[model samples]
Target: MPSSTYLTPRLADLSVSERPQERLESQGPQSLSDSELLAMILRSGSKGRNVLSVASEILQESGSLNGLLKWSDAEFRAIKGIGKVKALQLITIVEICRRVRERSPVTAPILDSPDLVFDFMRQDTQNLEIEKFWTLCLNRKNRLIKKVEVTSGTASNSLVHPREVFREAIRQGASAVICAHNHPSGDPSPSAADIKVTRQLRESAKIVGIDLLDHLVVGNPEHDPLSRGYYSFQESGLL
Candidate 1:
């Protein structure tokens, strides 16, 4: 709907002041809308469509600019004007954004609650197309000691062993640990495998004399059935 505000069918028809690049130079990047910013990335359009229209199509396909974080190369190429090279370019930019967003804090965060855990881990999970499990080692105060990736697996399942989960935590001298993984489908609801793995971890934690604080399933709230964005094992009284 925002793209409809552009009366001209092509960027060539717009005055220099009205153009996205010109507007960005004169008024700064913040002055331009989401579609305008995307147009700048796209650079040019196909024979019939303008770059603004192509950019608008991209936004509509992804649902929002933020939604582009989860998009794959094939998804970008499915758009009208986005070819292989453009899709690759888009993928590179998206990966850069994810890296910038997921960069760990200079001072580690206190990841006590499920909300805090979700906020801390979501960016790492954002562009993942498969399930990957990670362990967050926490000090007595619930501040992070270290974060470790335990296993990487398919879209539907990840093979996690309790030893793999606790080995790094023990090595780091962590007092407690939180384990987390992403759902590629964007629903954080735990699977049978997730429940089984949590139980195994809990029992093993008792033997290892370490706390199994929580197990989180990270996902996008937009696609989640509960719209809660993430599922926590401790919150459900399973930990």
Candidate 2:
């Protein structure tokens, strides 16, 4: 028989200072990195790699936490170190986020200012690989009623149409709407196409008796790799 004894060491081989669990319990969750937080949920790894390494690898494989939101349960389990329980945990988190996003938006402040609007949406689209167009529909009081994603794709073509934007706004009974999109290029500067599309949507809104309040472009204004900075057309008087 081949050597039955498993010579490979386990996570215990690492010092307590290097262990995610110990560090977390001692230092608190906020002190840890994203991988450490994820590793806490994962709890274990494959025979050779430890939980922290597994979590770091998973983050790299799936991209950021936002990117992980796109993965399926099977995809999570398919990773070498993750198993059924870890996969279920990850899936549960994703479903909870989905539910959170679906709730009504009116509880928040009126999204009248472009800066406020950008803050409202940067979470969903900032680090995305592709462009995404969103509409924030608001009531007469300017409180948000619903936020909808119209389209997503490459920078050149997101296929955002006035019909899609207004149809949702009308369905949501919104008196006015705010438009927003992210530029993966990290440049918040408006493209000629961006200006043209905003004007088109504004005209359509006028005809439909719905107001187009502002259009926002999200990007990395600070040139920071980890942050998705933004720009506002209304703030710059381009809308």
Candidate 3:
């Protein structure tokens, strides 16, 4: 019994005050460390390890709690104690977090500046392996009415049409629209095709009686030549 006890000092073996569930109830969720919160979710451990140690290993593999949001089911399952069911559950948890973050609030964000637009779209665009174009429909005050993905394409190119862009804006009854797309290569500089599309969109906006506020190319700062993480057509006098 002593050797077995040493081998598995599970949550049940821990003193009441030391247990994650007890601490959570007494001190609140915020009081728990990232690993402890994860331990609470995992509930148990395998072989000789305890749940807290297993949770710590998971965080170490992911680098941070935010990094874990981008992990896939396969990635979660690669860990020693994380079987198929646990992997699926973890993926579901991540998906729920993503949806909650994407839920619109009572006060919609005003995306008047390039910085604001970048921040609004960053989470949606992060870790994407291909190109995706988005249209942000806005009211007269530049507050977001809705966001729509107009197109998704390969690593190098995403087809964007003025029709698709303006159609969503018109459907939303938007007075203005901001267009954004990501470069998987991490360079935010607009390609020749991007410029040509923007010119076409500028003309279409006039015909449709909708303002084209800007066209933004999003990329990571480390890969962007300008290191700005994004390039704005309006700021460059292109729109």
lDDT of 3 by residue, 1-239 (tens): 35375555767777998898998999999989999999988887777778888898999999998889899999988887888999899999999988888873778899999999999889988989999999999999999999999999997799988999999899999999999999998889999999999999999999999999999999888988888899999999999
How many pairs of residues collide in model 1? 0
Alpha-carbon lDDT, every model: 0.92, 0.80, 0.91
- Lowest lDDT block of 10, candidate 2: 1-10
Model 2: lDDT to the true structure: 0.80
Off by over 4 Å in 3: 1-104
TM-score of each: 0.57, 0.54, 0.58
Off by over 4 Å in 1: 1-105
Q: Which ten residues in a row have the lowest lDDT in candidate 3?
A: 1-10
lDDT of 2 by residue, 78-142 (tens): 78878888789899988888778776353556887866786788688667888889988999988
Q: Model 1, residue 20: displacement in angstroms?
A: 47
Q: In model 3, what lDDT does residue 67 have?
A: 89
Q: Which residue pairs show collisions in model 3?
A: none
What ranges in model 2 sit over 4 Å off?
A: 1-106, 224-228
Instruction: Provide the RMSD of all predictions against the true structure, rounded to 1 decimal.
Output: 11.6, 12.0, 8.2
The candidate that wins on lDDT is 1
